[model samples]
Target: MKFHPYNLSRERLLDFYKNLLWPRLIEEKMLLLLRQGKISKWFSGIGQEAISVGATMALQQDEWIMPLHRNLGVFTCRNMPLNKLFKQWQGDLDGYTKGRERSFHFGSKEHHICGMISHLGPQLSVADGVALAYKLRKEQKVSLAFTGEGGTSEGEFHEALNVAAVWDLPVIFLVENNGYGLSTPVSEQYRCQQLSDRGKGYGMEAVTIDGNNVLEVYHIIKGIREYCIREQKPYLVECMTFRMRGHEEASGTRYVPKELMEEWAKKDPITNYEEWLVKEGILGNEEITTTRNELKQKIEKELAPNSARLGETYAPVAEEPTSAQSSLDEVYCKEATSTSETAHHGTPSLKVEGTSVRFIDAISSGLRQSLRKHPNLILMGQDIAEYGGVFKITEGFVTEFGKERVRNTPICESAIIGTALGLSLEGFKSMVEMQFADFVTMGFNQIVNNLAKIYYRWGQNADVVIRMPTGAGVGAGPFHSQSNEAWFVHTSGLKVVYPSTPYDAKGLLNAAFNDPNPILYFEHKALYRSITGPVPEEYYTVEIGKANQVQTGVDISIITYGSGVHWAIAYAAEHLDISLDILDLRTLLPIDYEAIRYSVKKTGKVLVLHEDSLTGGIGGEVVAWIAEHCFEWLDAPVMRCASLDTPIPFNTELEQTFLAKARLNDYVQKLIDY
Candidate 1:
């Protein structure tokens, strides 16, 4: 049977034609510019425009859509201004990402769109987060994400699908099977007869459609969207289509068989749709010609390279950029200046009596208080809800907040982290607890590439806190006892906070939630039960980037944080002759430089201490900074006391030997004598 426009109104049908035609014309213009050496690259959506146009038109304005690299129709269908999009492609400062990115790597919050990163499957999980918010808020909105057939191989694809299916989230996962993933064919990409068939394994309904038929694509998507909102369940839709051009302008199409191209060319979406419209007397050939001409003219006018500052020539490469050009300044939110926000920082405005508590209990108290303050706060992790977490930090949380807020996610780290980003996009706060700090490797891409880079790339705040239960003392081998704080500290955009005492744990936990940036809250597992201190019963937040000066002395300065703080204190108590000034660096990323400078200047000799291995630990960064800035104040060379460069052994005796505390006395005394 021949396809139709789903019986759309005459005006609506004409608008749909424009949506399909505009992207085709724009793609053509982009190719010309690429040949003329204006733009560096182009991902052609030449033949597969209907998938983007049809799928986008089926969704409402308030609903969110995650688009892929070739889905230019998503931007145009949402009514994003052509000039701004063209400026973005030309690397203009007026573009959405301020020329920080190129091509379609940018997303527009105003348009209710989230664009994909180079790693295609992470956005699928991010879309799940958006749908999760809709489910929680009862918004009756569904989120849709687009991916290529090749992207289905990513672990995030399976993770996102299973999480959505298990939770019955209102989301649609659309895989546009454009025949080829780069040069790899569908046969090699996956063994399934079709991409949608894999959805059944995820316990979700699945379907395949004639993607070249715009009306069929629209009809299926619209119905599926309604079904998802009503039932609050996920669905998988695969559109079988073909790309007419190479993957990009530079990649030639020599690998594609000639016969396949000829067959798909005859079934071209635009040409076939135009014939159907004319055959049914929906419009005459003259009208179709007139519309095509108008769209072409509009593309030319909007995409004209009028600015000498943009696209005329690329900027000259600089060996070193000035401070003004550094992205570090703009990536993090400036200190909140409003009276209400400022009041939440430092000490609590209302003084409350203190109670002695275990470090784990203190964390629970802070999280419980924050949940009460922010009713929409969400807590997610494996076995965190009904199971009360492995450490029982959230033992009674599920009873206080329902299952909706206290979510127990699958063993899908990438999806959960990406979902946290999605929650942040909709102005909700979320915290993801890694079962152990070592498992962060499973979600490393989503954390560093997506969460850490979001604010720097597109001016979006990822208001999510990742709780890491770290450090070693128990006989839990190398897997569970890694001190992995340095990995995130080296990453530019994430805020790293490791608190030693119960007071700082509760206070830093509160502050990390209140702050807008993505924060990694590292809780040393060894200190969870072993450490105890007085924590305020009432709500309070310790400043994130400030260090706590535990004690003051003049002989030698010991800078440390987390488990090292406890070790330093024990050593100081034993040695009264050598006066020790101890500084606990609560935050690692935005290291407390001022506090370090003051303590180093006072004592004249310094030792950087941390639980991480000595080779590339945060101690190196501290030592390097002290050498650069406080060289004149030093009485001795700056030294670092850390665990040996080896995995934490499981044996109790070996573990004790592996810890920095075993060698702490020698390192501190050597620095004092120097």
Candidate 2:
């Protein structure tokens, strides 16, 4: 049942054995190192080595692989140098998470492998995206994405599979069904008997293979790969494997039931494959003995430390990176470099040329100006093409620049951000629109997990500006009307900016578009048309962390941003009875604590406000920051006048109760009266 011609020759098989040997050792070594407290953590592909080895052996060196965490086997099976792999395990800069990248987060252009994150389902889609790009690029290359069974539970799995099938992409989506997600078993995770059965829904090729059998995995992967190059039809191979260890090194095995372990342990992948190899005359008992000794000797000899760097030895530790360290930004981000040669920092003054410029036109003008200066910039979201976008902000981009630069996505948020990550890795400036701010959460994982974490991991910077039309006064219900900036404000490694005026919008946006990290640029739906201020003719940078002071009053400090700043301004302009000091926070993540302190010290009173529901809104953090930093300076208890904690009710009257401007008058009156 197991003899396959694709299995390597005696010497090559021995080499394959050598290849197969260390990855397991590496995976196990990492597991132990984690227990030993050397590194923080890693995902183990111990039992599924057959697939990584088999599938990798199926491809040529030039083809690219987009691998999930459970892909240590691919490296092992391909006989990638063990020392470098071990160094990577140690979380050293020498390790391939490619320095600054998380340990085990593998990427090597030289190896033609683009390593993936621990996130499960997106690789399936990204593999397709990379393959699509390659096909268009006319490269003789194929892409493979490896994931686990639990990843199949994700909506993106179906989305990617369907799209790849529809487009006939040159991608191989290999699902290594290891029968568990942490402690959850596959049966509980899926209704279908076989994971591969779901592929029929996509109308592409699909098959289930014995994941433990190396030759079976190899031949199946190889055949589909050839089929892909010949027909360009994507393939899906489901490897019904087992999770031989805990999810990661840090996870305790206590959650796993004894019966399940006993069951999986009986089918130990390495042992079963070895027996098969021996019975088929591929190897004798002596060679198997020799291979085991050789592997054990290497494992014992290659002892050091876990590869990943834990979040610092202490919290709030500043990593002071120099300009040279920052120069990694230049070569690392392809998009960042693309337009640098052409980008003019101080863009010449521009007169408003058009006669009938709508609110959306302003948005387009700003984007066009920024794009003109940044050639690596690519804009695509929903109907942002001839449709000019849902808001008509990008109306003529497709016609002007063509689809390659102004693309039309299939409404896949993960792919949008994921592809943007790929582009950003090569220094491209990515401006992704989420259609609306509420939908931004769909792609939030990619932004937070990959884009935001990139700089923290491998020093890979994503100069990406995620623009979203946020806020809810105009009555778009729970699904559409939500002020989600607070969510991003609380996340680390992201810069959140909510600019109020056209001038600040253009200037602050210019600065954000230039920053090295990912930025959530929120444009309140309330301010897009109504709010207007003088935008200077020439491009100028607005400091990201500094807040704008609208007034120098002594009674109270009204703190707000985005549309709320306008409300605060209006409230101040009208009622001079209590000259309340106003502070407009530009960057929420890096909150302007200095401004908060200065204003609190001046007025001895504080009122934190926002249009979002008061419960756990971003105001809470601002209040906490003020309390911690300016407690003694407070006159009255720092007050918070946020919208009542409820969804933006569809009724206009109810909606008014939840808006910052609607309720802000009362707060101002009370402050003045006090």
Candidate 3:
């Protein structure tokens, strides 16, 4: 019963029917429940079941699949339990995401399925990463991602296709062109003849197939999957289909013309397939009825209450929270490394031992150490391979680790970051370097929505360290020079680390690599060549969420990080009469409040300093905390010394005037004299 290329027996044909029927029945039941006010909404895949069924059935169980919202057949074909899926759609605690998300928004690691987000295109690039993993490991596995016709318009779609093609990774970009994208007709969506043609633009082989013909889709994709693995190249398959129902049950299809609906209805996949089965002598009418009846019964059994009727109101089992504080507690992972319990009251805690190295070299040394320690560690960014990196941080990495470990990505920031998350999903650690910190805005959605929220949404850890070369000073202008640490510090699931010295830089980088959560490691570009300090040749780690006392004094506290630390040290050297307690905040998100409090209490005067602009900076957060907690100990009003509220100027003189360091003497004098 072999089907030529692969073992698609007669029994497998029957199983495909079952897979198609299951979603059709489930959609009917969900719509009924919606009418009864039991479920909130439903994204029905009434007629598009064949595409998912055929595509999923073609892939191996271990091969990863990134499914869209309409791919219920993908889950069923992968053998996800019907009961748990029902609970997930019902938003019950027993769901895969623990009711954090509803519908097809939850990824199941066990099923090898990565779920979709509201923003549709990121998952496509993530699939490229999964495929890249297979390529890197030389595994004969292909990664598949589902997207609609409208998704092709997304920049990520273009980036994913080009990346996969360039890398010669085994991946299938499946586009389900369902005539319309939520009321916008195909005519309005794109001017191209076929969505598959866009794939050719990326230099990949593309094809269009009849989505309604389940047998055709299954056969084509099965062959394509084999070709991808054999050639280690990407393929784009565009399935032409029509949405038999509205985008969601709530959004009615009033915009769809009656003539078009009537035309598509005559080509119903189930009815047509049943006729083909009967006419070809594969099965009788009775067998078709029997198969449909069994599918209906199975759905009924799964959805029914303990003793209630089949279609009766089935209330989900309620599960209460373990504790009221559990939600807040899980936001950050509990760390093994401990920070300072009590600050060095009036003494500098920094040891300053070992050979002196520049800040950039320390970073390079730490990265080299990490790469040597972990074989799965990947460094991804623009110009990071043979060209090293923008800062030569990975100069000899390609020769040492090869191109598989040191990947040079396209200028698609969003895609590279999403790829990092995908690599993490498949048990690989990644370090993504932004050529300049400003370019991070391109990948902001992936960082905030995907990486930062993945662990919180579905308990999937994103072991990634995004290296940001930031801060103003070399007159790099508005875009290149920016102390943008505050942007990620405001985000919840991310750890922000900013180090000032070579020793701290090397140690903190290693610490960030060791952590399981997503971390933002900010390296000030200005300090790269200028600052030199003692750095150990051996691998070591500095505890995150800790502050270091660089210089100890009793009169005033200069609380800062990055360039501010150097400014404080220089000011202290010149102004010998005034005593300054220079405290460098190594991490921003978990802002070493204990160290700040101890220093403020000891000095009785506080001056928050940073290279970022004054109005909405981390300095404001520090000043607010001081005002709230250490108001009674304050000798004068808590003041902030920060860059003027404007973009970093390109002119050297103007830049110097705009920087907070120019005003540090006046601010420190005022605090010390008070």
Candidate 4:
């Protein structure tokens, strides 16, 4: 049977042809640039351009698109200026990422397109959040997220589908099954006959279509999009195509079978569509030549030296705003004049004096107060809505704020963070709870790559807080108990906060809510009920970057935070002979260097301690900083006492031995004696 184009008006057919031509020309030009060593890398969608073009054309102008690296057709179909797109490849200052990134790692807020990272699957979850926002706002807009068949194998792929299906969000998951993931063939990637079939497990309608058939792809996507908007339910469409070329220019077709490549080459999407148009008498050969020539000229014009500012290093012409300027620009940026500041100026202050509360209660109170103050605040986590989270810290929140504000999510940590990022982009403050800090590994890519870098890259404040219930001691073994603050502290563009006391937890959470950046707020699980302190009822904010000197002395300085704070204080009190100065570094990322310098200078000895694994913990960074800055003042080498470099054991005695508090005590005493 001969192939025929799907039924469409002549004008629509011609438009699809033009859309296909632009990306085809762009891909050819990009390959030429790659060969000439003008660009660093190129991931060409030579045969699969139809998928991006078709899916993008199906969406409305206001709808969002979270495109992958190969979706240049989507950018073109959206009328992204060819000059800006070329400038991105040339790494020019006028590019979307200001030359900081290359290829498809850039997007425009004006266009409602999200810039994607190398980790492709996380964007699927992010698109879920965008769709969630549309549903919440009662907008008929739907989000389209594109990924490869290989991306479907990622954990985030399943997580995103589950969340979107459960929430009935308006999102279309487009899987461009190009037969191969890099050099690995699809046969080895998955056992399923069709990648879209996995969506059925998540209770969503799924379908597979010929990706090379541009008109069919467009028709199917349009219908799916309409259905999603009408029903506010997600649908997955797998477009089966082939990657004619290698993954990149450098990787030739060495891994692909010559016969398979030859077979797929004949069905090249652009050529096949062009042939159909010509055969059907919709477009003539002369018109096809004219269109190709015009597209080539346009691509060349964009690549012109003057347009790209070539030969000179491109630098940002506009001065980037400082942190203070950014803070002042935020709508939620209001300085707390005093600890007793209320939600409104004229309203009576709700401050309570000497009201003792457990650590968990303090956190819950802070969340409750923040939600009451900000109508746009959203709380999400697994089992948070009814079960009130695993620790019951968010108990009664679903009842008080209603389920719309307090959400229970599926067991999808990456999606939770990614969706929170989506909510934050829409000017909603989202506080996502990681049931346990150990599970943060599941969402690490989204947190570090997407959540952490969003603010710095595009100047968009990701006003999101990731509440990590962390630490050991309660016999929650390896996967459940871990002090993972060090991981986030190592990542730049993230604020790490770990509070030991009830007062600090309540106050710092308020401050985090006000801050216009992503904050990783860690709460020690052991301290949830084991500790209690006076917390004010009114809205109060503890300065994010400041350290509190819990105890004052001049002999030896012990620096700690979270669970370690209690141990250090107890040890200091037990030995009256040692004059100990304990400093609780509530914020790890923005370490109070001045306070550390002052304490080390006065005491002339320093010991940094934490409950995280000893080798790569935050303590190592502290010790390095002290040695670099306060080496002259130090009377002894900076010491550190942390949990042994091993996973937390299930046995109570083994766990106690693993996290030996005596080791910290011995280190502190030795520092004092030295």
Which candidate leads in lDDT? 1
**Per-residue lDDT for 1-674 in model 4, tens only?**
13445666789889999998898888887686667666668988889898999888888876889999888888888898887777677765567765567788867777878868888898898899888888888988899898898999898899999999999999999998988899888989999889888888999999999998888788889999999999889999999899888888788889998999999988888888888778889999899889889888877776685444444443333224335555334322233323442221111123447699999999999899889878988899988988888888888888889988899988888898999988876778889998888888988899888887765565556778999999999998998888888888877678899999888899889888877788999999999999998887777877788887787788888888998889988887788898888888888988888888878988888888888889989888899999998889989999998889988998989999888485877887787667
Candidate no. 3 TM-score: 0.95
lDDT, candidate 3, 107-141, per-residue tens: 98889999998899999988988998888888999
Which residue pairs in candidate 1 collide?
A: none
Model 4 residue 331 CA deviation (Å) reads 20
> What lDDT does candidate 2 reach at residue 340?
26
What lDDT does model 1 reach?
0.87
RMSD of 2: 5.9
Cα error, candidate 1, residue 466 (Å): 0.7
Instruction: Give lDDT per model, in order.
Output: 0.87, 0.71, 0.86, 0.83
Looking at model 1, residue 504 earns an lDDT score of 84
How far residue 539's Cα lies from its native spot in candidate 2, in Å, is 5.6
Tens digits of per-residue lDDT for model 1, 1-674: 27865668878777777788888888887787778777778898888888999999999987899999999999999999888887778776677887778789978899998887999999999999999999999998999999999999999999999999999999999999988999999889999898888988999999999988888888899999999999999999999899999998789799999999999998888888878777878879899889888888887677564545335554422224446647668878664412222122111123325888999999999899889988768999999999999999999888989899999999999899999999988988999999999999999999999998888788888989999999999889999999999999989889999998888898888888888889999999989889988887888777778887888889999999999998888988999888899988889989889889989988999999898999999999999999999999998999999998999999989999998989998988788667
Give the backbone clash total of model 4: 0
Better of 1 and 4 by TM-score: 1
Instruction: For residue 47, give model 4's deviation from the true position in Å.
Output: 1.6
lDDT of model 1, residue 200: 89
> Candidate 2 on 1-674: residue-level lDDT in tens?
35464636777665556666668766665666566555566777777787888889889976777777778876665556766675565545456654455555756656766676777776666576567666656665678988778888887787678767765778888898887888788878999889888878878878999887777777788888888888887888899878776787557578778897788887766777677667768889998778778777776655423222332331111124346655344333333222221111112223432233333445566677777777767776787777877777787877777776676667677767776665554456777888889897778778777777665555557677888888877777776788888787767678888877676676667776677678888887767777655554444556677777766788888888877787787777787777778887867877778778888898887888777788888888888888887888777778788887777788878788767667776776676566
User: Which sequence of candidate numbers ranks them by lDDT, best first?
Assistant: 1, 3, 4, 2
TM-score-better candidate, 3 vs 4: 3
